[model samples]
Target: MRRLLFWLLLFALPSTQAAEELRLTNGEWAPYLGAQLPHHGIASRIVAEAFALEGIEVRWEFHPWARSLLLAERGDRHGSAVWLSSPHRKETFFVSDPILDSTYYLFHRKDRPLHWESIEDLAGLRLGATTGYDYGEPFQRAEAQQSLQIRRLGSDLLGFRQLLAGRLDAFPMDKVVGFDLLHEQFSSAERARLSFHPRPLRSDSLHLLLSRRIPQNADYMLRFNAGLARLRESGKVSQYLLEAQRPLSLGR
Candidate 1:
């Protein structure tokens, strides 16, 4: 009777299983990525839910953008989200399909009233841009040739503030993000002073970058992409993007 009771008790106990976790790295780029925001931001939420469909949980490590890239390269983490695809990075990482569209544009004070039809149009102006970020080949080439006086900073938040202080005539950043940050870091009175140029400086798609050094990462990549496809087919991706536009869309 004791032996039978022992077996029955063991079989009746609930079974516990540990969830599979994917460690991903990234940096703060508001509305897209902010450690304090819900699901660590919109892009992060999308990536997490996509993987969740495959029974994978995401654990994000918020680091500086460059450091986030380094983490994936070193295989300290499985992958990094929200990076633009480049030939060199593609050679080293398993790049995912378009995670989101990134649109870069010039931002300046409303009082200054600056407009640039082309790269050459902004000649002689003091420009500000984020360090370690690629705006585009032409913009980079122009910077290399000293076409405009450029000031490099680590964050667009700082760059925008500097522009307000008259330290920089113009700064460049993502349109959606700029708007997102504007409401976050400034009040309506302060926001009235800044404006984004109608012409986009450059446009690119963001991707999830996975290191090739990890033997099993290839399979993980396939699962993530497949899950992402299901989300899109079910209209979840569209719904997410529309919701993301809420703070900016409703007010503006």
Candidate 2:
């Protein structure tokens, strides 16, 4: 009878508790999640709206990209949005359904065209990358072999400046971020003089990477996915993307 009662009680127990809030880690990247603005950027707004649908409050912690990633890896934080998914990271975390599609493109002087069929084509060229920015699989693997010259810049703005000044031969950055920096840091004349490689290095979906250590990750992911589904059905996601890209459309 005791064993029967125990089984009944176990079955009666709640499957999962409701998450009171979500804690996200982010860095200084803009047009995604800004360190200074809590509600800015497409990812930030999407996450905020998704959690709100579940009655979960959203909070953010802005740190250096490496430190923010470490916190997520250690399960000290819930997740980080706008992160690329990889097989290695999949072992430690659950990635949400893709929040957005992203492309890594090569930035170069407009006067000089860089023709490259693949990432390997850039071998022996000086390339600038922001510190802690993952270059996806091929570039990451190629970089490991020391086949490409990589200059790690402290910030995207600085890297664009370096590229413009001819200090670096090429730079790989997200298309949106590269465009944002070009407009924010360079004059119209200067911006007009810059261009991206004809082809993207890689195109993939970006996701909200939830740490496996969080006990409520499954619940969070479910709720987030549900909300995203509703958003997509209602065309809310498309509207948000349009708004996010508004600034880019001007004069482009």
Candidate 3:
């Protein structure tokens, strides 16, 4: 009886330790979260360090955003980063405090002579959006009800092409991504023809989304928030941004 009890305790230890480990799912979208060679990106680095602070190990899997979200939604994965929190997602997962702030800008041709003060201002305009891209509650709701002419494109680059060809009147995209795409994919003349609205459609906080299925996620959430606070206090967050932005600035 004593020997059997000791063997049972030994087996339980491994399972307990495994439960504390975290598995993160991400997609390859550059300048935010991507599956680049050495490491994913700055967000992944921040996530890894935050988990490390709490003695948690993180592993990542790269997939399409839709599939990645589905895995996390079903509790098949531990969590995901750089996701916008919305009422739609609150039921399936818990979101950490905002890890970053993102701005959604409307891009149009330089010759279009259109300006948008707000999302409502764009009503009836043919706007393009990337499939599976979440802007915010108001915009998403508007898009769903067909109040706006939102065309779903396969990729951001495609949307840019459509806009230039007059197929799409305008497209909504992140400022960082918009600049990157313009610099990388557009010719000098083409880049000059593209312009963005002076104001962003909206700005929102981005959070690290954790699966509720993982019993340890509550504790992990606390650690992530605490770690982020520490980074902010130490000014590390600003430093990280400066480093990440260096390459983008050099090209200009």
For residues 48-150, could you state the per-residue lDDT of candidate 2 as single tens digits? 7887887787788888777888898898898877688889889988988988888888888876778889777898788998777777788888888888898
Model 1 alpha-carbon drift over 4 Å, by segment: 1-17, 246-252
Q: Candidate 2 lDDT (Cα, whole model)?
A: 0.80
What's the true lDDT of residue 234 in model 1? 88
lDDT of 2 at 9: 98
The 10-residue segment with the lowest total lDDT in model 2: 243-252
Of the two candidates 1 and 3, the one with more favorable lDDT, higher being better, is 1
Give the residue spans of candidate 2 off by over 4 A: 1-19, 246-252
lDDT of 1 by residue, 103-144 (tens): 898888888989778899888999999888888988899999
**Residue 60 shift from truth in candidate 3, angstroms:** 1.0
Best by TM-score: 1
Tens digits of per-residue lDDT for model 3 on 198-248? Answer: 677779887889998888788888988887787777777776655554233
Q: Choose 1 or 2, whichever is better by TM-score.
A: 1
Candidate models: Cα lDDT each: 0.86, 0.80, 0.79
CA lDDT of 132 in candidate 1? 86
